[model samples]
Target: MPLTRRSVMDAAAARFGWRRAYGTTTEVDALLTEQSETAYTASASHAELATAKNHDALAVQPGVLDVRGRILADVLYLEGVLTGARNRGLPSEVIERLEDVVDHGHELTVLLADAVRATAAAHTAGR
Candidate 1:
């Protein structure tokens, strides 16, 4: 299946042991969820913009560019978090899995941005 914000986030959560606590959760898990939610929201907004019928419609939409920006920021933050975890001596295997999640998240963010740009260009040319 294609990489997506949700899938990437889920992978990250699993790697970080999200919700595995019998009665509590760790900071890493909470951080992952928070970051993932931010990305998810941005992606949803971008998807809505991608459905615009014309450049003008997309242009007039508030925060159209912000969607991509937000996702990019989230990806970067997650990468930094992973790097810190690695530095703190997380198990090599777990770190590797988290790294993969970060990589896939980055890829999805890029793909989403590209798709939105392509949609906007197509709308512009259709005018």
Candidate 2:
């Protein structure tokens, strides 16, 4: 969903009170800053990701992008303040992390599905 000012404003009003979920602009900025810093920080390990790279990342790129787009859309839908997290104000580190997610998102999706299937299989076997 394209985020318009009017739509975000309405969503913000609904998610937040006359104020916002954050008590102060400073609080919001601080949290955004922390998230940005974390996102920017280099990960020490990505072994699971290396092991999971079965398919051509290029071939799976579109679907992965779509999935990520939806996740971002969901976030915007649920929490409409891009002033801190979504826009240019966001730290470069945060942006890099988001890109990394997009890059390896298909593997993440497959991992999640496998977990779910494992749980279901376990439940059925017990039954």
Candidate 3:
């Protein structure tokens, strides 16, 4: 269930002729940049949410952190699909199929956080 670099690299090479000696470095570089950006964005959002010192700070607003997290999750899903498809040298149609199924696992994370914050607020107010 976990991802491995070797699997990703092997899949990419098998699909796209992506050998160190033969592949286009530009595509690989671009994919890595996108992935890193998504990860950094997600981290910043989570940090803001987790570092809040009081429940009030967490309430009365939609946390930018969760929105950012969802956006980043979507980006990561896309990156994985594109990287896998590119490595396999898949056709555009096939790549589109993969993209359709890419799972962005952030909605539930955001919902859970919201639920926790709401419970905390209700408890604080003696509800």
lDDT tens readout by residue for model 2, 44-71: 3444554466243343444445665666
Which run of 10 residues does model 3 get worst, by summed lDDT?
100-109
lDDT of 3: 0.63
Highest-TM-score candidate: 1
What is the per-residue lDDT of model 3 for residues 1-127, given as tens digits with 9 covering 90 to 100? 1236645766888798774432566756766776799899878777566567346544534554566576667767677867888799999886776565454344445565676677567667874
Ranking by lDDT: 1, 3, 2
Q: In order, what lDDT does every prediction score?
A: 0.70, 0.55, 0.63
lDDT of 2: 0.55
> What are the per-residue Cα lDDT tens digits for candidate 1 across 1-127?
2337546866888998893322345545665677799889878867566567435645533454566678788879888979998889988887888888889878877876776777677678878
| Candidate structures ordered by TM-score, highest first | 1, 3, 2
In order of appearance, the predictions have TM-scores of: 0.50, 0.30, 0.30
Q: Which scores better on TM-score, 2 or 3? A: 3
RMSD of each: 10.5, 14.3, 11.3
Steric clash pairs (candidate 3): 12-87, 15-87, 15-88, 15-89, 16-87
Q: Is candidate 1 or candidate 3 better by lDDT?
A: 1
Pairs that collide in candidate 1 are none
